[model samples]
Target: MNLLKSLLIVVIGILPFVVNAQSNNYKVRKCFGYQRDSCTTSANIFYKLNEDSRSALFVKGQSSQTIVSIYNGRDYRISLCWDHILGNRMGFKILDRETKNVLYDNSTDEFATDFEFTVTQSRDIIVELSIPGESTLSKSEGNEELIIIRKDKEMGCVGVLIEHMITPTKGF
Candidate 1:
């Protein structure tokens, strides 16, 4: 009877840890491939997906970046997709990796989420994504010491879909 009780105690003690671990894993797995699988299907008809396309969990006011090689003789399209909680006008920028010159900024184009351009020269470039909003903390009941946690502050998936194809020859 005592051994059974001890085993019961052990199971109870381990239960919370196992549950917490699974929840965390679920959060991560949930975000994986979110953008590519859900958002980019329409584009697949025209452009082949580049291997660097990816998705990740993002919080408001967070920024993330990735580098990819843009080869000459190809036309490329970059599209951004995110959970509505992350807002509609997320910022996206493409910069020359070595020179740090801004090649493209979505803000200039009315914050358009999709961009298409033909590469004239092969180069490595940086693709930067930014989510807009304040941090998760907020004042509660006009008290600075008290905090109000918001469910909307939860992380959401952001996807950068990169697709490309050979630039078609022009003029017969």
Candidate 2:
């Protein structure tokens, strides 16, 4: 009976690991859609990332992107680039939303993932990206593009391309 009891305990411990391992089957990746002239293109990169993963801003020569947004149909994080910082410091202000809290703030431009915060649900958050002396705001009451994401192995995003504008003063 003692041997049987030990066997059951071992199985219980292994069960959790096994279950957690199953979650790895779903491949997590990021899709970046940028405009090439008047037409847009999408660049998909596959990796194992969680909802808490930092949104990819600039991957080497991809500095064309000014903002990085991520949402797993629920939790989300918004990141801005270094060029958007004003007065030598990036601005990250938490909006009055129904959920979410500020977690990381690299507004000083000392880190890669700048202005990282969590959200219980994805909502329109006011983000002001600009340079030291320039003022560039993406806020609008018109037609704004929405980004939606999901886990892999089940067909994730459907035409999720990002958009950006060229700030004359904001340099790479």
Candidate 3:
């Protein structure tokens, strides 16, 4: 009985470590073919939206803020994708890092899945990703509910894909 109890305790202690190892391995798998890519069908659609840009991945419920340089007179397509298990709850926002002015907010825009815009000036912009709390958000400042989704202790992956739009030249 004593030996059986000891073995059971040992297995239970090591179970978490084993599970964590498997999850870590899954995260680093070549399933996406790249670190910034996604393996889901929905994500594949976004990947085809633009060819000049690549995608970046993050864990669900965790916020990611990135500073990117936007060139003047250039159009960019920014898309967001989650594990698909999380549904359409994933959203992102673009803000002028210096002025804190919101360049784009998906939540207010009917939970838009993507955005396309042309910048007039070259500047550093902040891209933020979050799991929205409310099903719908209105255009009111300081009254939005910012909720994080905790689907599981080991949350799945989310991706942000940015593609630069090619402008047609005047040459004929």
**Of the candidates shown, which would achieve the greatest TM-score relative to the real structure?**
1
In order, the Cα lDDT scores of the candidates are 0.81, 0.33, 0.60
Ranking by lDDT: 1, 3, 2
Q: On a 0 to 1 TM-score scale, where does candidate 2 land against the true structure?
A: 0.25
- lDDT by residue (8-126, candidate 2, tens digit) is 99999899888645424435443232111112221223222232222222211111212234442332323333322112333344332334344333454563333323344445443
Better of 1 and 3 by lDDT: 1
Residues 101-172 of candidate 3: C-alpha lDDT, one tens digit per residue: 998888899887777776778998898877543222222245656844343432555656676644434579
Clashes of each: 0, 0, 0
Question: Which segments of model 3 are wrong by more than 4 Å?
Answer: 1-60, 133-154, 169-172
**RMSD of model 3 against the true structure:** 9.4
- Top model by lDDT, which number? 1
**CA-RMSD of model 2:** 19.7
Q: Which of candidates 1 and 2 reaches a greater TM-score?
A: 1
| TM-score: the better of candidates 1 and 3 | 1
lDDT of 1 by residue, 1-172 (tens): 9999999999999999986444246456766776666565443476888898888878777788899999999999988888877787899999999999999999999999889999999999999998898555421234557544444455677888888998989999
| lDDT of candidate 3 at residue 74, scale 0 to 100 | 71
Error of 3 at 169 (Å): 6.1
Query: Candidate 2 overall Cα lDDT vs. reference?
Result: 0.33
